[model samples]
Target: MRRAIILFVSLGLALGACDDTGATGTVDAVADVSADVSADVSADAVDTVASDAEVTGDTDAPSDTSAPADAAADSVAPVDTGPPPSCPEEAVTVYLYEDGNGASNSWYDQPLGSDDLPLSGEAVSITRPDGGVTAARDCGPGRYGFLDLPAGAYLLDVAVDGETTSHNLGRRLPRAVADGAVKLVAFGDSVPAYGPAPWFPEQLETLLAPFVTVTLSNVAIPGSQSSEWLPGGSNYVNRLAPHLADADVVVFSLGGNDLMNLASDFEVLGVEDALALLDDLDAAIVAIEANLLTIYGAVRAAAPDADVVWLVYPNYAMSDRWAQYLGDYQELAATLLASKLEGIRERMGDVAGLTLADMYGSLDKPALDAFLWDELHLNVAGHRYYAEEVFMTLGGVLVGPPTSRGVHRSIGFRP
Candidate 1:
């Protein structure tokens, strides 16, 4: 329970403050404490929405706190919306930090986007929502922009030294918005974003092109945990929420990396400490569920008309790396994890109004084996499978995939 408390206390203290200024100030205080006090906190996060224009951190909006969980669940409304409105245009600005986890959030929150120094003089390439690409020139300290570009969420790549970091960085500047276009925004972990090739969202866009003009942007980080994407988490503030204002369709793919961490932890634990590790798993689930509830609320509040796609995970049993180091307890560890995942899937199915895409249940056994890229992550073939399945399930009021293709073979992704 203390492990869960660490996460709750960090978020409650850091994000459960006032407006934007107070948010940052709370982060600074958490920093002054230590890891025990600061797990992850996004100063720019959106928790509760009083209006579309103004987003505030609602300490009572998530399930982490006992007082608000019942209220949040009871007050939940169905997802429904009319025709798209003429929203203001939006531009995004990128930021690079030498190291993350300073005043605003911990390294746990911002694995790539937190640091003390404002980064400049780096080369940035931004891919526009309509598949056009642009370059970002340094405007000032720790800031960059694309001159003469129209407002829309775009994918960004930043090269610092010799390493490349890709994400949909920065907030959307309300200059002009996409007109008569589908604003598809995605932010999550590497399941959809893993690539030397087109991502799952990109593949989905390709599948969607014949039906509608889709505008796409994805900020899927490689190693981020779900805890960091909570209402007050770093991914929420810096990577996810900023582009939500004009979103027509939003999809999320996370929880894989969090499971990877749990698996990795098992390798270092002794047989005697197995119970403690199980406790850790429970705490992690609590954090992820709380994070999801808050995230769902925030999305609904921010983009009431948007269609949400909750991309569930494929099978993790294909990867047995969790027990690779266990000499005698390999079977035990694997059994425990498999059982837990089953329960998770069932619970999600029972949850009302959650638009779940059960990628786990629908995956063909052969495809589950053939497409299990690098064990846990998916390869190109997997993305194609996901796109087709999700496309068929999308009865969303805002957008629907082409019906003629049906359950046939993928037409292949764009090069």
Candidate 2:
């Protein structure tokens, strides 16, 4: 009842406001005002004559002789600041996209991966660091742009498909044009890079396909010791180095294989040798941490501005499949995680330019068990979940369905 009352009052106020605009609502303004402006008396230009009553009265009722001077302008779209700050010049110049979904189709609902459909007329806004918001232009059916984005990173909120509320994409908008392909390079070991098909990197590419093109290069090799990707490691020069030049984003997970053999030595070497593996695990961990930092250095060296993310292995011993491989994979995974936080200061530093994604601490134990394909590798379900988290971890992903057709390039578009 209260809602109905509030709605009724709101509706009355809206109608009252519309009636006072020196113009009628959309239908009346287009119909009656167009005719009235045309019926201006032939005396002195068209705008001269007005009904005395309309001149004296405040309402939009047209004068018998002519419509008000501003009536013709009622047909015009509201003046806006033209293109958004980050909109690509090429997109605007080519005029490749259709003129938006228009007023009527603005609320059409489309699901993710529906790249075949024209970009919807979803409402978009960019909130500046200081919290000023700039709204979106209606140009869609493949085009969308924003207005007055300040010089700093801002939160982009878009109404997904036809949802009433806007969704914040957890991060700043990429500077590339809406349809431009975002290059994603995946590195490290089997945790996130497991392929054969449907790994996290691939799933991420699919999730974003409807909105933007993804150029994914998964460089993960199973049983890859982190050392293999370090400066002088076997795969460093050939597989990893060449790809970093222009990467937009890079994600990788390592550390498990580096320590697994040392951990297994605990079972084989009894007495003093076993004691050394026990007490000297710190030395190994420190070296592995250094290896990780060196690997990150290479990525930063090659693609300085790329968004780099490091995924830590989930607790593998939590799964029965992993029990046979390690002396105790669960305890070993946890020990490495805690020691990294406590003893290894380099691993525990600020986010800096590199982001560390903590899969070990974050993925719940049940998921660790359920997602495993073997002793350490994640299955398809696990891959999809990791992909979702990775997308979320790299700030936030855009909420609406991504586009199929790119403006300058014809990569992601489908029929």
Candidate 3:
């Protein structure tokens, strides 16, 4: 994975209230009063025309053509039919990525194969052509945007740790298209919604912005398990169905909490006792697998055309500690968990447009200290790593300078 040097524009207000109605009128003075305007007028032009209408007294429909010639001719200045309006500022989208691929156990998880994790809470400043500099911190997983920025050449400075990296914006900035944005919806548990700032979905959004506009809606609830998202479950087919129906892509992480919660039941038992409880553990894994398949089926049905990505839980670095507490049955527990995930992956392989994100094999034990917040949840760094893996898995190309992270392998089955 490569670190990304991306840019973004922050449109100040929520665009929900924006009127899609366009401006109407013709360039010819003798045009019919009831004639509609050309549909080519942009949204900005419509706004300008509406504002101009309010400024003048033409609140009613077009003036009567039967009016006296002098009055009709004189009305031209007030009605001021002009060329299409041009926005004074441009919108820019920025994405930042860390350079290091995540992996575990495999010697292949060398430094050359890692992704640089996203630098969260980094300071970003933009210098305008007139020598004015505006500063803002990166928000939502290395994403920052400047909306309505004055049109001109600009400079971007991102402060990573104590060092500042700069990039020139040349003379032109990317403009937002009215209908070019991609809609994405993320479902599942706490790992994806790890915190308020650097969640993986948001980071993925920032990385994909350069290629297309993105409107992401995260419907993942904290503490949610796979069962809650199954066919008759609450969140999957009910709460998030509408979003899934309209999404271009859907990403989710699950099964960890289910396994962890199940493991707790046997924590007080000795190794022999825990061994005796294997039947219960096996049943739990079977139930989880069934629920996962049910959820996958619902997602496919609801979002027929949408691409779905499933993130497998990473290897629990604290399994040894957990085993110590559970009379040394850690290996058995870990094997069962891995088996469940493998079964799910094999099942997903048969589904068209569904991909598995093998985070389980992505990070090794040595990398756990920096990534895992606990035995289960990922810290901010871990979330950043997960996001990059996802972005790469989804075919998003890093657009900045490349590093020596070796040849990145795409995770999951891409059909």
lDDT of 2 by residue, 61-108 (tens): 224212223322121111111123234532211111122221111101
Q: Is candidate 1 or candidate 3 better by lDDT?
A: 1
Can you give the TM-score per candidate against the true fold?
Answer: 0.50, 0.51, 0.51
lDDT of 3 by residue, 1-415 (tens): 0000000000001011121222111112112321232222111111110111111111221232122222211111101111112221324334444433422111111122225444456565655434456674333555555555533333344444321111111111112111355677888888778543567788777655655568989988877789888766667656678687677777888766675565454432232343334455457767877787778788878767565777766545223323333233333234334444445544444444455555644443333333444445554444555665565444322221221110122111111
After superposing all C-alphas onto the true structure, candidate 3 shows an RMSD in angstroms of 27.3
Model 3 ranges off by over 4 Å: 1-179, 266-272, 318-340, 399-415
> Which is the leading candidate under lDDT?
1
Clashing pairs in 2: 84-146, 100-140, 210-402, 210-403, 211-402, 211-403, 404-413
Clashing pairs in 1: 89-175, 89-176, 89-177, 90-173, 91-173, 99-114, 99-115, 100-114
Candidate 1 structure quality by residue, lDDT tens digits, 182-292: 778878887778732556788778756644577888887878777778787777888888889988777887776675566554532232243344467678777777677
Any runs in candidate 2 off by more than 4 Å, and if so which? 1-173, 176-179, 232-234, 264-274, 323-351, 397-415
Q: Quote the positional error of residue 297 for candidate 1 in Å.
A: 1.5
Stretches of model 1 off by over 4 angstroms after superposition: 1-180, 263-270, 319-335, 396-415
Worst window of 10 by summed lDDT in candidate 3: 1-10
